[model samples]
Target chain A: MIALDDTDRAILRELTHDAGQGAGALGRVVGLSQPATWRRIKRLTEAGVIAGKRLDLDLEALGLGVTVFLGVKLALRGRTALGDVERALAAIPEVQTVEHVLGLYDYRLRVVARDIADFERILRRRIMTLPGVGEVEANVLLSEERLGGPIG
Target chain B: MLDDIDRRILRNLQGDPDLASADLATRVGTSSAVAWRRVQRMKDAGVIRATRADINWSALGYSVEVSLRITLEKTAANAFDEVMAERARSPRCWKSRRFWAVSICV
Candidate 1:
């Protein structure tokens, strides 16, 4: 496991809240100079502690107003088959998040769409045709609140 | 409506939000002040929710990840709230230290 100091954790926390605030701003929050802050961030990124930066765009603003969660049961349960299914699912633009979860299903999918018609099209034309896919269950998500970061 | 400039700015920032305003301006063919203003406007408009750091949890010795499926009893009043409150106290959840994105289905 990679070791993280208090300063490193503080920096991560600050970045988790707002990475858009560049190195200089992040430094001010973490009590480090801009160059020192940049160095630490660079080290973290290079060491694989900080994976990547992501832009959280509003889906409704982008015309995707519906959110659906899908539980997928596979006909063939194998590593290769599952990988192929996941890759195919990921290729769909509307498929926002895919998780190979435990418990009730083999895979869980989060999909966003413009409306019911658009979601139906995706389900029929794309999702159902994927290899090894069977017994797909859909749940319309009413709301989502992100309470924690991936790093935590 | 988002014009070409707004689209360009979003695209550039989405790829590398760490870019300085001047560099972003150069990429999108806009002045530094214009780039800054557009970014700020997008943030205020809620088009850009947040830029976040992605962490590799598995590399942090958290090799095991499990998703729990909890169903509240329909008969009990405030069962959902009670169950969630109980869950909130789980040490494994590390709610104080980490974040979890919770989705509610109605």
Candidate 2:
């Protein structure tokens, strides 16, 4: 693991907030020259600490107004079943994130849809049809607070 | 109210928010000035919230991550608000979401 100093942490925090800021502006925030800050950012990128910059889209404005967390328990407990289910889940466009977890459920999924009816359709038609899928619990997200990361 | 060009620009930006205005314009088949204006308009309309650094928490020495589902008592009228307020005050609570009846802390 690459060791991070206070300056590196500061740069990360600043970038986490507004990554579109110019390197010179970032430098001003982190108390460094433009080239110096650029080098640090480059290093961080090379080290895979800063994965990439992503646009935070307002999904509500895009008409995707519903977010649901689903806990899926598979009936079969074999590796082949797991692979099949995972592959099938990945193909659905609305399935934002899929996590294989060791807990009450085998998989957890973050799904987005245009509305409640849309979500129900996706869940019944797309999700329930997956191989070895048995029990499913879904929680519809009412509101969310995106606290970026623990970098400050 | 996004046109084809606007959608194209947004798709590219979502993939790589650091794309220069000129490069983005080239990819979207528009003038740099037009691309900048469209992006500005989207930002103003709240379609584009912010460009954020996607940090790799595992690479940053945060190896273990947990998702906890907490259910609060429905008897309390202000239970949800109180719990949400408390979570907001905690720095370690990275992302918190209130579902229909459950609160997910990650």
Candidate 3:
């Protein structure tokens, strides 16, 4: 693991808040010179600490108003079954994130749709038709609070 | 309120948030000025909230990731608010979402 100093941590915090900030602006925030800050940031990037920059899109504004967390249980348990289910899930656009977990459910999925009817259509036509799919439970997301990363 | 061009710009932005205006415009088949104006308009409309560094916590020694599904009791009126407030105060709780009657923490 890479050992990060206070300045490194501070820079990380600032970057997490706004990745679009130029190296010069970021240097000003963390009390470091532009070149020094740039070097450190470069080092961190090379070490894979800062993965990449991501745009936070507003789903509601994009007409994807409904967000559902689905807990899916597979009827069959095998390596091939898992792969098949995952591959099929990747083809469906509405299935945003698929997490294979060990608990009451085999997989947890984050799904988005225009509305309830659209979600139902995806559930009926897309999700249910996947291989080894069984008992499913869904929880619709009402609101979310982004607390950000562990840089405190 | 997004048209085909706006959607194209957003799609490109999602893949590469740091893409220069001229490059983004070229990718989306639009001029640099049009691309800049659309991005500004989206920002004003809150369509594009923020561009953030996606830090790999695992590389920073945070390897284990757990998802907690919490169910609050109906014994107190302020129980949900209190729990949510407490979660908001914690730095490790990166994201917390409230569903119908369940809270998921990640």
Candidate 4:
């Protein structure tokens, strides 16, 4: 088992805010050499704390014009529905994230599209195809005062 | 090659990665040379990918957030490939955060 100390967490937080920072820059903040920082990052990746480096891009640049959240409810007998649900959603370009959640809702989706009609086509055709999916509710995100703001 | 001073340096950087090294060293109570070397070494390793990020929404002229859930059957590998491809086509799919843990006594 691997236990991350306070120092390790500090490094992670720094990376989260700005993943583009180089190890040399990170070392100055985290107190390691470029090599040592590299090693620690590799270890973190192996340990699952650090998944992978990603670039936060401009959404509109890719032609996704609207953002919305969808709450999906499925029948209790839908354990078998997982297969159809995943495959169908995977084909929608506007859908960015899929969350399996607990509560009255079974799943939540973050979607981006040019407009509501685009969302309707995907929802009616792909998402509703699941055998157990019963209720699908959507809340369009009008303005995000804080996008990707730090949690905790 | 890290002591108490080095840890202090790292802490400062974590809060604000945009600070200059010489300025950062001054705040960490160390000389510029030591700070520069430490930073230089960290860069040689992949511990840090970069330090500059321009995140100005006003300049970009757009806003977005997208979330979706995908349940897959068959080979988990094939499903994952499809999901990744979907993510790649959409710019809003960036910043994927996930948590998974497994424990075993070997």
How close is every model to the real structure, measured as TM-score?
A: 0.77, 0.86, 0.91, 0.51
The numbered model that scores best in TM-score is 3
Q: Output the better candidate (1/2) by TM-score.
A: 2
For residues B38-86, write the lDDT of model 3, one tens digit per residue: 9999999999988989889998999978888888888889989999888
Question: In angstroms, how far off is B34's CA in candidate 4?
Answer: 39
User: What lDDT tens digits, residue by residue, belong to model 1 across residues A24-64?
Assistant: 98888889999999999888888887778988888888678
What are the candidates' individual DockQ scores?
0.35, 0.51, 0.54, 0.04
Off by over 4 Å in 4: A129-131, A143-152, B1-106
Task: For residues A1-152, write the lDDT of model 3, one tens digit per residue.
Answer: 99899999999988888888889999999899999999999999999999999898889999999999998888777734677788898779998889999898889999999998998899889988776888788899999876765875
Error of 4 at A83 (Å): 1.5
Please give, for residues A1-152, the per-residue lDDT of candidate 4 as tens digits. Answer: 45666666667767767777678998899888988888887777666655454434344543466677777776554465676676666567667778777665677778888676886777677677656777777766654422233211
Residue lDDT tens for model 2, A28-59:
99899999999999999999999888888899
Docking class of 2: medium
For model 3, which pairs clash?
none
Give interface RMSD for all predictions.
6.7, 5.0, 4.9, 17.3
Give the higher-DockQ candidate: 1 or 4: 1
State each model's CA lDDT, in order: 0.78, 0.87, 0.87, 0.62
Candidate 2 off by > 4 Å: B21-33, B76-91, B101-106
Question: How closely does chain A match the true chain A in each prediction, as TM-score?
Answer: 0.83, 0.92, 0.92, 0.77
| Model 2 pairs in collision | none
